[model samples]
Target: MMADNLMQSPENWTESQVSTWLRTLCVKEQYIKKLFEEEVNGLVLLTLDEDSLMTKIGMKFGPTHMIIQKRNELFNSKQNSQQNAKPTRSKKTKLQQKNNSKSLHCLASSEVPSGQVHARDKCASEESQTPQQPCILTSKENCKPRPFDQEGIDLIYVKHRVLQPESGAFDLISPCHEFKSFAIAAELDRTRLQAKFAKEVLKFATGCMNIRSNGTIHFGVMDSKEDTGYVHGEVVGIPVKDKDIYVDALDDIEKCFSTDKEHARHCVRPPRFIEVMDRESTAKNYVVEVDIVPSVYILKGKVHAVLLPNFNEAANKVQYEKKAILRRVGSKTEPVSDSDLSDFFQRVKERDAQREEAEKTLVLSTPFCQDLGRKLTMLITSGKKFIENDKWFIFITNKFKPDDLSNIEWLLNMKILSVFDFDPDSKISGLCSKYLEHHAANMHSLQSYSKSSDRSIKGFTEKLHLFEQTSWLFCNGRSGFKANETPCDEMTWIKTRMTLLMVYVSLICKHILPKGSLQVIFLLTSPVEKPLLHTFYGFFTEMQGHTDIICICESETNFQRWQSFAEEICGTETVNNFSVVGMKMSHINATMQMIQPVKACAKKHLPVFVKGTCLLETNREEHMASLEILTVAKKHLPVFVKGTCLLETNREEHMASLEILTVNHCDDTSKDFINEEKANIEQQFYRGGRVTWMNFWLAEHKYVGEVIERDAYQDVSKLLMDVLKFPL
Candidate 1:
């Protein structure tokens, strides 16, 4: 017989023929060589037992069992072929025999006898087999129609039937399968069907929702262990009779997830049920492919959770439902710890803050008004000139509406009186009056000016000199006034001098000096006391709406004090609009020369300043109340105040005894006192009193009737009223 024919009937094969068959089976080379060297032919292979293979051929159990399995398959095929050659007696019998033949062919092609072959071996055999001819197996009365199309059934076979090497089969849970985005379950628990299945679905769904991904669960697929100790999936499939029960159970399990009315539509999508055929079995068995799609409306900073039903003793009825939060860590779904949840909230808060900051920066970068830009340019040019000339100058621009003629008339009349002492007959005063009465009817006409004669300009300059001398006297505390303690008369006189100086500069610019836009430039040649500095700050603050102001300080101490005061009054955002430059008198010329080019370029763009909308009185009252409360809590606590409110108050004698540090004293002794006070305050707040006491006091005082009724110093009024009702 030919070798190929002999291979079909393995009992008739020679020793070399047996070796060829073993090679095709992919048995290890060493085992093949050993079997061949032993002179074992097909007859000997069929008779060989596991012990004989191990003892005689020195084969391992895996190879030994594989050889035995192949030997039995060949023997069975030979016996079946011998029986098929028998002649039939009748036509009816022949037809029945033909039907049996087709069924056998299908059984051999698709199904494997239980425990006879491994999944890998079956896969290899299928790959080598020719395309199957159409058979009448589907026409059998016992076979049920497949629920899904052939393509979907084939897909399930390709993904779930092909067991990954690293995955554990027949295990309760496998990380390797989860890592691939799918899990296998043999069947639902009979004892606690709904509760058990709901738990598994919630865990997987929560993990998928938290990580923003999708996954799948393959039910009715059995994972089995091989003789080689490797585990893999086997598609035994769910029986057709129990299919409805499993489908209904999955639907009920999906309802266990928690969802609000707002998020009901956006909750996790219902898992899709796809019925696939059991490729390894001929029985009408199906595997349900549960496709899990995570929630699409997941919100930032929110952690997803599921409500798992807790069952009673019999496991039939749910007693209650408990919330559980889970997140995916690699292939495993783990319960989130308290610390991790807190950290997640913190990260979300920080991200929100950063986003808001970025938005604010974008808003501030938008182009400002064109009119503002022009005014800013003029201010810069005038400021540069004043710095170069080392002179005090004030430029006033009309900001009043054209229809607001009454306020305009009052402002101009006040300016004339402060400058010329109400001498309406004076030439310059008469000129201002004439302009206000007729030419200043509208804002555009008010900007127009006629050049003043030399006599008027000279007179304005001499008056400026007198005002300059008076300012020096007030600043230096001369004329019998103590430093930083100016009398009301001296303060009024100093303000009058400031008004005269502004008028003098305005006249000079219209006639002889270079003309520019609204700006106030003050060159402080000597150190002014704190009260006088406050006066200057107030004056400039009032004019801020009409002009851009700059203060050049000859003393570094005065500049720092001015900046601190501006921030305290106007807040940091508004303070930035007012430029305060401190430089030594000797280096003033050089500094101005170096910055002139940069300043000239900067004039093209206007700087944006967001004014604080908060009222100053409310802020000051709050600050004062907080200070007093702290002082009362910690007796003998020294407090500092910018104004003389606490010093003048007789209502609280205890507050008067407290050392009041004034801002005017910048000497080392005052600095030491301030530092000591800061340390004492810090310690008192931290370790001296119970925080609950202060909190209760503030909360009780926040809505005091007197404070609500009062327009100014509401916080201070609230504190004083509540102090009487305070629980000592």
Candidate 2:
């Protein structure tokens, strides 16, 4: 009645009903009710084992122990009720059962000794922890049971065992014999029997060890309710003479593990074989049970042929000797591959890098009036403070001309800060000519300022070439625009211009500047209004060492907007301060504060730098013809640049367009690289394999935190559509 009631409405069960239901099985009603309210849920109580009921659900030991007993009573009652309702078996059915019993007894009498039956049951119960059943073995004339402790292992003949059903002969083989706890082997090779048994033992042990709660290896047991009964298998019986068979089998197994060179470390622990005896059988034959133990780590190794049960399969199937690198693929254990290992290792490297990065100190450029005042004073009074024999430095400004620098006292003190402006598009050759023009003008300016001798002119001119070569002669973004006539494909042209600027800057820093230089500065006028200025923004972020960006905005709005852009490009909420149109005091003060840290850091570290760039081989017919005209005009530059800007102003519009976006510092660069590369590889500075170590160190630098955004899916799809529409 209880089983029927549960099946009718398992979910409708109540605490009162549970107490009443378990009361008849010697469970006190008060205890059942109290435990039910405290720890047990009426609906799930049937699903939990006694140990889980006590430990997991916080049930009392006495009441939890009676749960299985109450469950058995209900199940047995259901069985008795069903039997009473069913009609008696027909004559044919009775004859079938009788024939099965006779077949089983005959097989048992011929093959298994009376004592062996007891051993088989004992082994089954010990290994599987389940109730044992009678099994019959068909023994030939030579078939004999071997003792577990026999020092010199001998040939032990065996046969397949079939389970005997209630009132039937041994008609049915063991249920899904492949998944059963015991394995039966027929015939014996005298010499290699121990070796063979050792191989077989590891197979079953591996199968049991591989089991997981949510995994597919669901062979032993499955919990079921009245609606869904538990799925369990009967313990399999192995026929052997005595318990000593276990001793000999285990010894050989341990010997195999000790001798194997490749997989010896994976061995968890030694296995033990227990002796079991059948009390009802009047035979000397016994069963030896092999039991594998659990360990802290998962055991993995190659195992010979072993059969393991699969819930998805109809029966247990044979598995060959294969490497056991079980990895979770979806829900099943699949062999791991090289790609998986590579991905795992990459993740580990990234985690270590991130942890190391978190421990470093960071310096922020805070805007303050006092700091600005100090910076302005330093610029004027500390003219020769940066001089060092081993180091070199250079400075360039887009806003200030040579006339503006002539009046500055520091200009006379610092030899590297030649007030001449340079165009990025101008070649190294053009600068070579500009060097002569700049030297003549400087000599005249100095002569008029000091009314000094021609002897001092030689010293000035000696270092004049170094200044001309290193200083900004002409890095005009405007020249790049005039050179590239293609307005329809603006972004591509802009990318070309940015690449030119970056390459030029990189070359100048590497070749022109002194190795281990203290400082380098680039001053820009009205930078935020230009399109794709992230080229400059990204360059500043990537060039982390002692480089300063001084943006001279045309208005307060432009200054505020550029500051916001700096935050995005730098990947920080608070970045280096910039001077506004009417806030000269605050700007200079902040610049001074920023420079203080640079000076301190310069003493301890050298800037990370890359070597020069090799020019690409391409069709430069236009460039070649223009080179002669450019050289004749004394305007040959190191590289060409074609600047372009996005035609949007609204922040939302900029975000929506296919422009590269800024990533916050917290964003994972690997994920960003994956997303960005899939869209546009050229836009991303950290192009993974091309600059892995460079990017890693740069990313770790306190000042460098920004990254470009990945291309939009819509943009990618539209581009693909256009390609398909106009296929070549």
Candidate 3:
């Protein structure tokens, strides 16, 4: 009523006077918000530039462009209104006005110029002047607000091998970029954002997982060319076996993962002919499971995950319809409308109030929980980079969108608690405890957020932690989350879901190199392991021979199992000292125990190394070993008493390298048997390719120096690379 009365009286108020009055009441942030609404581009880069104090403060809508636009609208409107007011003024007044316009012009283009406001400073001050702060809040590790927990990773793969000069794989990926991940990112098209988001919600949020395997297009038949059509399809999983379940699964999977034929080879297969590929490719592939070891493996910035908030579709629909109506009349925040002028400030405030109250109960109660927020954050980061081999390495997560963090899957960060910069300068475990206790709105400590469809971070420890020991086979996407997804009729989603699994396993092989909690030593008896074994024997001898002992054995059982042709390749005497226990041979773990003593003895005098077959199914053997530890017996080997990890590898060079590693594992007190004088061990070569045995069965010895699987033993050649360095 007063505003209307004042407008009518206008006590002789002119347009110039009113415009000036309005300008006095304006704050920088409000003005910037207006500019935000006017800009077409989505991103706003608020950088510092020297020499220009004139940049209107607190408004960065799009790169530097929006700032310029806002400045023009701000001062120009004033100048135009002034020039038209009081027309009878002198020519001198007009000249003064023109000078003011010129001064404003100089300030407008002064980005980065000397004596001008630094671009960074200018943006800061403008933002400072505003009551509401814009969240340029980058997705920093510090800002993650939560840690991940121990849970829900099905297949883990790690690829620690450096790029071999000849591995044709370097060709399939982009060479210009140092090393982009196997996955590629596509820009979100305007129309596709909602669908893309919806799909993510269904797959990750709804617990309906679908991975793309193969994609094909089928055009109309030649005879029915009149009504030509094409069908685009992918592979999907619907934990259920029903027909309707298949259709539903296919739809949900298709809705989320778009198909790409190039990434198709990245999945894990049960068992097949390896005449083409080694098992490590599946093991060292891109990882996709959530677990303690897995936490330390997956590198950030791959297209590996999409977080889905547990939003109820029905509730969201209702809220969307009712929000404006509720806000229209005397609400705490005004002006929320059909216009795109969304209000995050008010929304966040309301959310905070509601979330705070809901969490008050848990925050005060849970005995085990300390800092829920920190635990959630730790869980995510830890799960991303699970430590393997106790290799004494560290992983540093990069801030989102920072160039330095791009494609940097693995890096050597100095191992100091300070580098992590956790508050109180303590280890991660300490910080996590505190954060989960006092900080989480819900004092629920971290369990696993990745495995659940609900927005929960608790109560699934028993089920989610089962990732390490169990393998759930998916038949069209129904791998069994609590509320399994509905399936689809079209088999289109199957290929995609399968493809996702392969990629997941590949990364697991590459990153998820779990520590053999119980280490052991292995003897290579296969003829094929001989050549590589010989090479390693020489390499190790050069460093410290007494540190390790090499063993090679020829078995009558092995010779009879192979066909005559395979037998021709097998020579008995080459693998001389290798040992074998009884035939409970069905158990790979029990067999590995025989080699554990060798490792234990080596560690005592110098260093010891564990051995596995060419198939290096040590991944599976890990479970076997765990079972042995629990069900069989627990032996307390000394700290130096490391055990063997029965790994599978076809490259003889790897065996030779392992021989060198065994020596590398030793110190002054340990004896080494893999050096130059005992070079006879280097003469060994590896053999075997059947499922009946690991990739390598024998390490045949040559009277001469070792002959390896050609070039696979490079890691052995450079003996110093694996050394663990202490931070100064």
The residue-by-residue lDDT of candidate 1 on 1-728, one tens digit each, is: 54464546666677888887777666767888888888888767766776698768876545565566555555655555566775452333332343334322222212233333454365577325423333333211111112211232212221123333323211112122331111212222443555555556656656655544444444444333221121234333453445455445545444555554233224333333333332222334455554443333334345566776555766667654667677666556777787798775556544434434433443323333223222222344554432232333442221122232222221221111112111112122322344444322211111112224555755754544432321111221122222223223434534434444344335543543432333354444333333334444544545544244555443454444445444444554554454434333323332232224332211111122442122223335456664532111111111221111112223344566654443222222354554455444434544644333323332344421221232344887788889967734
lDDT of 3 at 228: 13
lDDT of each residue in 444-538, candidate 2, tens digit only: 11112221245354453354554444433333332333444222233443444444545545544444444435344433333332222433454
lDDT of each: 0.41, 0.35, 0.25
Where does candidate 2 have its weakest 10-residue lDDT segment? 632-641
Predicted structure 3: lDDT: 0.25
Off by over 4 Å in 2: 1-368, 376-396, 399-413, 417-473, 477-493, 510-518, 527-532, 545-555, 571-574, 577-728
TM-score to native of every candidate shown: 0.24, 0.22, 0.17
TM-score between model 2 and native: 0.22
**Candidate 2 lDDT score at position 148:** 23
- The candidate maximizing lDDT is 1
Q: What C-alpha RMSD separates each model from the true structure? A: 35.2, 34.2, 28.7
**Candidate 3: clashing residue pairs, number:** 170
Provide the clashing-pair count of each candidate structure: 0, 51, 170
Rank by TM-score, descending? Answer: 1, 2, 3
